[model samples]
Target: MDTPQNTALMRALAEVPGPLPTSGVVHISLPHTERFTVVGNHLAQNAALSTTAVGFAVRIQSLPQGTEVGIKALAARFPEGEKLIAAALRELEAHGYLHRTRVRLPNGRMVTRTVFCNHPEALLRPRPADASKRGPALVAAPVSTQAPAPVTAPVSAQAPALVAAPVAPHVPAPASVPAHVPAPAPVTPHAPLPAPEALETPAPPPVTDRPVPAGPLPPAPPAPRLVPPPTAPKAPPRPLPQPRELTPGLQQTAVALLSDLRRHAPELVLSEADIERLAPATATWLERDAHPDTIRQALTTDLPQPVKYPAKFVRHRLTVLLPPPLPGTEELAPARPRTVVIPLQTCEGCERAFRSRTPSLCRDCRTACEQPAA
Candidate 1:
């Protein structure tokens, strides 16, 4: 009869050997009785029987009497190999699922003897009711049985004892009288004294008339002299000089000199014609003297201004030298103002013109040009 346990064991074994099937059972006739079994093929030669009830029985029968199954042998038989089988065995031992016994081999070295429980369910089940919990248990005693004694005492015993005792009454004696008692004498009723006489007042003496001496009153203090404060010294007024207009020639010359100085030495000042004429000498003198104010004063007084007008003379000279345009020619061609308009690119960052194509000032000036005029 094939039981469920036998069937499962056979199936596991059959997986190891192809020849063994679920329905196939090998009957091995031992010398004593016929044992029904499964004969696994060569693959089963290395198959391991688990450390279970069925596995134990199978293992016993599978190995020869002298055969010793160690970790290596079990590993060869285990599906996952020896290392995994050894690990599983350790785990089972830790979980109380298996027990191990150490046996001494003939080599004098210790080996393991593993045993498996037939009923794993029983090992995993809850403990019996009679078994105590793992740790200590606390039991509380009854409070009424161990109560303390009362502290109160009987009232009559605690009270003090009182006895009857009599006290004598207090009596005060009367004060004694003096032996010699003298009575006070009676007061006499004397007669009234006479009233005091009135004092007499003397009359005042007669008045005498005496004339008071007269003296002339001194003249009233002389009237204050009204003396006015001294007038401030009067300033001398001078006659005004006639005004004169600058000659056009002088004006033109000044303008020309200013323009020339601006072109050569922009820092020079043209305060007066004399100063302008003496500018170069004054600048030279200042360089030698190291005193610019002294040069300035000398230049202002030393240079002479032109006496005659030059613009009138220049115009007359030009008119005589150059021919006048024809009457129709003048109408045909009116003079156009000649102004040199430098290209923006020619402008140096300075207001002056630059001859080079790549002006140093153009880029800087570009930013200024881009700004809105204030």
Candidate 2:
């Protein structure tokens, strides 16, 4: 009979399904039976037991609502079947993949229910495999792990022992060597030769036709004489002052005053009003303080006399005026009209008004006709 431990081991082996072959393994593109098995197994080991009545669960919280399979169907496909299914459900509950809620049954009794939960990580992880058994390949086992050999000693320590020692000198027999030999005397260097006596040298020959010595340079030409410049001529003395004649107007006034005095000796005094009226309009011209009588007389007498004039009538011309615009005239000026020149042409077909300069109809008609021909 098989031992209980051996049977249990066999059961464990059976429970542990072999990893999918590399070629046979299906990529977990979407959730299916194979993917569900792997996920369910992982969740069963990770989740708490009491969360779900089942021992294991494939917490597919990210799975959309109204999915086809239930816990029973998912568990049936896995190796451990119902046991793994219970575990998977518990794992899914623990990981928050599925939520548990209390609901009233049709019979009026309240019961705990399981539903898929929403989580970003659970949705992104590999999905359960389909019934086709397609998923990614399983990981391979590790290779051997043997220990390495010990390291040996360095060459420096062993070099001295491997080397040989030096040998002593050997002496030959007398019969093989020379009989009587004189000992060599000590060597000494000879004295150096005596130096020659010093001799007197003759003086150099005199140079011919060389210029005579400059004879003290003739006393340096009596450094140039520094004569003083000629003095400037003195200016002539100025002339003495001379008297000047008076202006005619002043002379006339003086004569009139003297005549008045002579004619009326007893009443020589003039009225203040008459004297003020006779005064010149410009006071600067008669100002004795600024210009003395003598300087004034000299200036007035030297100046050219003024000409006397009599008043007379003269004619003046009038300037001409331009005429004003007439009433009801137009406000804006008319614009100039533009002139355009048209080129003359001879058409290949009609040859009437068409001009050949631009080849308008000939080129266009040819292009249009060529398309149909092509």
Candidate that scores best on lDDT: 1
Clashes (N, CA, C under 3 Å) per candidate? 3, 27
Which portions of model 2 miss their true places by more than 4 Å?
1-64, 67-73, 77-79, 106-111, 118-374
Q: What overall lDDT, based on C-alpha atoms, would model 2 receive against the true structure?
A: 0.40
- On residues 270-305, what C-alpha lDDT tens digit does candidate 1 reach at each position? 445543443332233322323433323322332224
- The weakest ten consecutive residues by lDDT in model 2 span 310-319
Error of 2 at 300 (Å): 99
What is the C-alpha local distance difference test score of candidate 1?
0.43
Candidate 1: the clashing residue pairs are 48-77, 75-82, 349-361
Error of 1 at 330 (Å): 99
lDDT of 2 at 85: 61
Model 2 TM-score, 2 decimals: 0.17
Candidate 1: worst 10 consecutive residues by lDDT?
A: 192-201
